[model samples]
Target: MISKSTIDQVYETARLEEVIGDFVQLKKSGANFKGLSPFTDERTPSFMVSPVKQIWKDFSSGKGGNVVAFLMEHEHFTYPEAIKYLAKKYNIEVEETQRTDEQKQEANERESMYLVSEFARDHFQHNLWESELGKAIGLSYFKERGFEEETIRSFGLGYCLDHWDDFTKAALEAGYQLNYLEKTGLTIIKEGAAEGESNRKFDRFKGRVMFPIHSMSGRVLGFGGRILGNNKKAAKYLNSPESEIYHKSKVLYGIYFAKKAIAKEDNCFLVEGYTDVIQFYQRGIQNVVSSSGTALTPEQIRLINRLTKNITVLFDGDAAGLRASLRGVDLILEQGMNVKICTFPEGEDPDSFAKNNSLEELQHYLQENSKDFIQFKASLLAEESANDPIKRADTIRDIVNSISKIPDTIKREVYIQECAQIMNISEQVLFNTLAQIGQKALSDAGKKAREAQKAFEVVKSEPVQEKIDLQYELERKIIEVLLLYGNEEEEFEDLLLRENEAGDLVLEPESMAAKVYEKIFLDLQEDEIELTHEKFRTIYYLLISSLSENEDFSINTFLTDLDRELVEEVSSILMEEERYTLHQWERKDIYPKEKQAGVSQLVSETILTLRCYLIKKRIHSLQQNTEGSSEDHRETLEEIMNYLQLNTLLNKKLNRVLS
Candidate 1:
């Protein structure tokens, strides 16, 4: 557990712009920094970072929070992990409270697996550096591959000694439970023990060079190992088996290292192997990652979709491998990303190609040779279908199917036109095929939705009534004003509307000055009203207490004291306006009203409307009671009539026409 003082210091030291800028490409927009959302795929920017408020909002996804919360949301970091990351980034020493044995045992299973994987990574790294056999074999292999000594260390490349029991014994000696080690796929425990014999335990990556696969936040999730010696019985590369914390299909190699570059370059280079990513990265191509030889999954594509919508896939020159990987292009397109295929010359892969050429030559070749998915697919398939009309027809359909996966109508139309020109087909034929595909897709979707609705209806038999709660929105608005302008003293005016002797409504402006929070608090209390919503009520009390105690308002301080959910709620309120860029109505010869110009009237009207709602509810309750109990009927009727008159007058003051 981190101490409160340490958390506060860390929050105060970490700058919001600097922290988010590491993961996003933010350009200045007015006083704030704006960029495409890292949470969703979009071309126009909807993510905003406010330096003065020390918060960020992704209007596309409705996610907003301070720096720590952003890390937690974007990288899936736990609270302590996020704080530790910030502290490390800003070079602040962290102080944590000592935990008891019970607290230590309370860690969940996934975290335990992470701890075990981390321990294994450190143990293997130690072996690579300090052990004679590891140095002679694992270190020799990496150096022979032209990997720099610094690169080897930074990527957490390591070695496991050939002796079967070496890593397993060290892990046990260090008090790590065998169960966790086995669960992480670091140590394999054989089943069906002989009589009077302990179950066999051995290292999974023995006699291999290790590469630690990390999550987006840089936590070690698993390891991929390359065999160092001739072991025909074993596979050349062995990866950690599926565990609680490691899913190969969902994890992309080197995302932790390449995310920043991908965002900056606005393009990601996708390769096939781990070394391909490392080699490209070492040669100054930083925006690259590998699928670790697994078939690409939608989850992995969505991972890349977070940083940018442009992917340039680097394929090996080998025809077999290239053909097998071409399907990934459609998957990328289906996720609303633009994918281009870049194939090296025969007998060269990304690793060899990057190593053989200068960085400039490699980059120029990539820029000049990369082809869009439609062009690449047609050209690649055309060579095999020459003079075979049937094969050519099938090839055109395949291209059309890929185009149909694209969600953007304009992009789809453009691709279809390009495909028609390349394949020497009529545009009408392509259009008919596209329409058929789209109609089938819609029919399938409708069928699935109907089935889902039927299942939901069977499980939920009762009708649920939802109330139109006006007070909740009004209460939230009041909190919004308090948080945004609480300490700023400003002039406020209310419009006094009344019927003059000439029987016409006249508006009179009355002005006064007060701190924003003071006026809001006094007005609500004067009307004998309190916030009714539970979350708003809690926030209201906290705000008042903090103001009275400190005599100042700090958004950062207020957020630090809030729980995670409350932090999200408060940030949502503060960032709601930034969700859409403000339009310049005046530019088009139209001047719209500004909320800032009439803050006093807005606050007064909000309070008055709330009071009117309360009075109407009271009158309704009195009428219901009067029908059941006639003993106090006259009193109830008199009270209800007076309440109605007051409600009517309040509505009149609000300039609301009577219905």
Candidate 2:
């Protein structure tokens, strides 16, 4: 359990822009910062972070919240986890309450696995520094490879002892479960031995250097192990097999460290090995990640898209696997990501070049060498053809095919033109290829859409009953006013438009928000009634608190001071509105209506008061409908009578005010 005071400190100390800016590239726009949606693919920026309110709203996905809530939503951190993340980011010390034994036992299975993985990482790291064998084998191995001690620690490198069962036995002894061990592919559970008398525990990676693969949020989902001995019997490297937490196809290694750099560079440098990523970062080219030598998948591409749109893939120049990896560029194009390919000089890969040169030199070489995938492919194919007519023609079509994978219309046309010039082919030929591919893509999309609709027909076709209760329409209206224009000054008709004693009409300065809320409060108390909707009840409670607070009306401050759940509700109400605070129509320099200022204020006041009155009427009706038997109906009758009198008075006041 976390203390409320600690949570408040974390929230108060964590700046919205500072926290999000570490992960997202936000450029200022008016009072907010806008960036591409991390949750969806869009060229135009719809993710807005408002510094004044200290909240963010993604117009595309409709997720909006304060900093802690954003972490919970964006990175999938739990409430406490998010607090800890913020605390670490801002250097705040955490003081968590001790958990009960039962509460510890009741933690979710996934969370337990996460804890075990974290423990394993720490144990390996500690061993790497403490044990003689680990220091000699693992630490020395990293040092020989030119990795600094800090780099090794940063990447969580370690080694497992040669003896089987060492890691498994230790983990199990530490109160971790064997079931999760086997599930996470850290233990080999055999079926034939001893009729299931322990199934024999053993370490997955023995006599091997460890490289723990992490998620973007730095959770140790799994690990990749590299063998140290000359074991022709064992593979050179092995990774944690797919499990409940780790999916190789979806997880890109080094994204945890590289995400901020990727967004800043506006390019993801995709390498082929784990060492390639580490070496590049150590050399200060931090905007690099490895495919882990696996064929690139669309899921991995989408992960990159969350951070940036441009990806530059770096491959070994002398490697035999170039042909196998060329397919990734097309996949990148299909996702609408701009991709370029940089093939290093012969006998020099990213790891080698980075180790040999300074960061600036290596970065300059890469920048000068990188070519758009289309151009690189065309040039490579051209050289391979050596002007052989048939191969040359095939090369042209292959380049065209790569261009065809691009999704944007303007970009496709431009690439087609570029290809025509490079290959000396007609633009029409390339455009024809692109049109064919584009039409096929559209047909495929339509087919998938139809299939999805069929699969979800029950849900999609179900009738959507109107959520608005007719009796409570005015209640919601009042809520809308409080949510939107509650702080605006307006004229309140004293006694609801009644003439003054001097035979003249006059208006009074009464806060429409306070007056209507007070009326609703009084009416509810008189009938001993309650708001049906929990969210509505929360909003009503907050409104009462706002009234209870001293004057200096501040919608922003009131909202910022709310609890997380109600903050979300309030933000949804406040931000969904498309208001032109510019007030362009109000300025006389442009155009103005007669007495628009006072009339507008008066009209807003009437709307709010009327809404409160109607909500009160609905409450009365609900009270009447919810009455028990007429036999013991004295209190019920009294409630009905009192509600009717309140409703009639509110109605009269509302009509007079509106008129």
Candidate 3:
């Protein structure tokens, strides 16, 4: 655990602009900086960073936060990872609280599993280089696959020894718990052991070359291993079992390495195996990831969706492989992403094809051969159906089903037209089929919604609270004043309403001066008024307490203690007026007044308006209570009249005409 003081130091040392600039190209725009959003592809600059408030907002995606949040969102760093990154950047020595063995043991199960899996990756890599059997067998196998030493190392390729307990023993000797090893499927414990005998545990991937699967942020989540020898009884490839930290359906094999390239190229080359991903990467085609031969899943497609909307699936020319992976195309379409299909020459997989060609030749071939998903599907399925009318009818319906998965109407129509041209079917027929599929989908969705509605009973909504917009607006304005000009002292003329000796109320302008915080606090205290909204009251209390404790208050320092949501709201409030770069009014023959010129009046008027709004609400409440015929009904009527008089006076002071 990082010490609180160290976390504070990191937050203080890291500047929002400087931190976000490392990943985003920002140009100075007035008091803030503007840049293209890193979250999505857009030509316009909508991402804004404010140095004064120490926050950033990506207008395009509605993501905004302090410095630490940007790293977490963009780099996918965890809280500790984000903090450590900042500490390293600012050259701050992090101080950690020393934990006992009991505390260490209390670490969460998922984190422990991650730690164990990472250890396994490192252990296997070490074995590949240092163990005699690993080098002679596993290293030789990778080398024969045309994987260079650097490529093998980059992907964390390694070897597990043939002996059942070799790796498991090494892990136990290294002080790692066997429980985690078993949970990660790195070690398999034999079931149904004989009496008086300890349950036998063996390595899960012994005598296999390893491929470490990483999360988007490059943390080792799991592993895939290929057996070196063709043992007729054993599976050729094996994967880690689903664990707390490893969900096979949710992970793609090489996403960590391919994310940036996918974003840069505006497309991704999705293959099916670890070797295919590695070989393509080695051949300078870095934007490629593999599903590790599993059926394509929606979760995997969403992983690609984060980087780009375009996916080009490379298929082996073999008919069986093509047929097996065809379902994935529909999954991609359902995600609202553009998908293209490319088939290699006969008998060549992506791995073999890339290995045999130069980088230039491979790039050109992919560019020239890739076809729109619908076109490719129709052409391929048409050939397979081949003059069989009933098979061809099924083929058209299959294509229509895939088309129905597309969310865009225009794209579906375009696909239908293309299919009609290729299959010699009417566009109207395809459109009608698509409409029926869509209608059925909507009906199923409606049924699910109804079922869910029944399962979760709908609660009655609470009565609407009557909102006083004027009061709410004034409350927000008061907070804005304190956040912007609280420390500044200025002179202002406040109206004094009094009964002169002439027996009539007279208004007099009285000169007064004080710090904004002092003026606002005294005014609210004298009026006995509190901000009605819970969020506003919380902000007000914190602001007053903070200002009282420190003679000189720093908004940036104050923000470090706030949660991300509050920090964003406060920063947004402070920086709202500065969203568009400050304009040079003088150049346009108009002189603009500085905020300091009106600070005293603004602060004074904001407090006065809030007090006036509160007085009116009190008067209205007392009048309503008088109708209840309580024992104090006459007293309530009197209070209402008194409040009404005060409300009138306050309205006069605010320069509003009586209705």
Best by TM-score: 1
TM-score, one value per model: 0.88, 0.81, 0.80
lDDT of each: 0.85, 0.75, 0.83
2 against 3, candidate with superior lDDT: 3
Off by over 4 Å in 1: 1-5, 21-52, 56-64, 97-104, 446-467, 490-514, 580-594
Candidate 3 per-residue lDDT, tens place, 65-156, comes to: 77877887776666777887799878999898664545535666766787688889999999999989889999999999999999999999
How would you encode candidate 1's per-residue C-alpha lDDT over 223-276 as one tens digit per residue? Answer: 999986777999999999999889999899999899899988989999988899
Q: Please rank every candidate by TM-score, starting with the best.
A: 1, 2, 3
lDDT computed for candidate 3: 0.83
- Better model by lDDT: candidate 1 vs candidate 3: 1
Q: Which candidate is the best by lDDT?
A: 1
**Per-residue alpha-carbon lDDT of candidate 2 for residues 182-202, written as tens digits (9 for 90 to 100):** 878877877665665655667
